[model samples]
Target: MTEMVRDNPALARFELGDGDALAVAHYRIADGAMIFTHTEVPRRLRGRGIATRLIAGALDSARARGLRIVPLCSFVVDYLERHPEADDRAD
Candidate 1:
């Protein structure tokens, strides 16, 4: 991904891209927890690990705020399974 992506909680998602090629990792916050809902990357950006970066950034933000993560999205669940040390776990 040529464009650097950042976490944008004001939009309720992490976003990359400026045009129709945009990608997003969407989530919701509830009960002091963050629910990772889904991750979408344009086909052109799919193999570049953009989703992984987005997930990492989002998880990091959640951790900074002391928010527990509820991995509703399969991608997040998979990410957590592979990186247990991330520990953005839900109570």
Candidate 2:
């Protein structure tokens, strides 16, 4: 299973693979508007849908907080493009 946690106020990271193989990191903020700054799923974890999960989690968090989203991160922008339901929260 992927172990993910909000290690900090503006960051959520997930550990993938075994030992130090790779880690996926995403930076996000839920100010008046939700903004996702960065997303990176190491090459080893690339095809595993980790990015999707990260963005979904961020979007869920935004929804819970009743905040609009501004997807500055390319990954998030692309994800939202594919998932139109998420676009409703865009600001």
Best by TM-score: 1
lDDT of 2 at 64: 78
Against the true structure, candidate 1 has what lDDT?
0.83
- TM-score per candidate, chains pooled: 0.85, 0.71
| Every model: Cα RMSD to truth | 2.0, 3.1
Q: Tens digits of per-residue lDDT for model 2 on 36-68?
A: 677767677677776787677667767777878
Q: List pairs with backbone clashes in candidate 2.
A: none
**Residue pairs in steric clash, candidate 1?**
none
Residue 22's lDDT in candidate 2: 49
Top lDDT model: 1
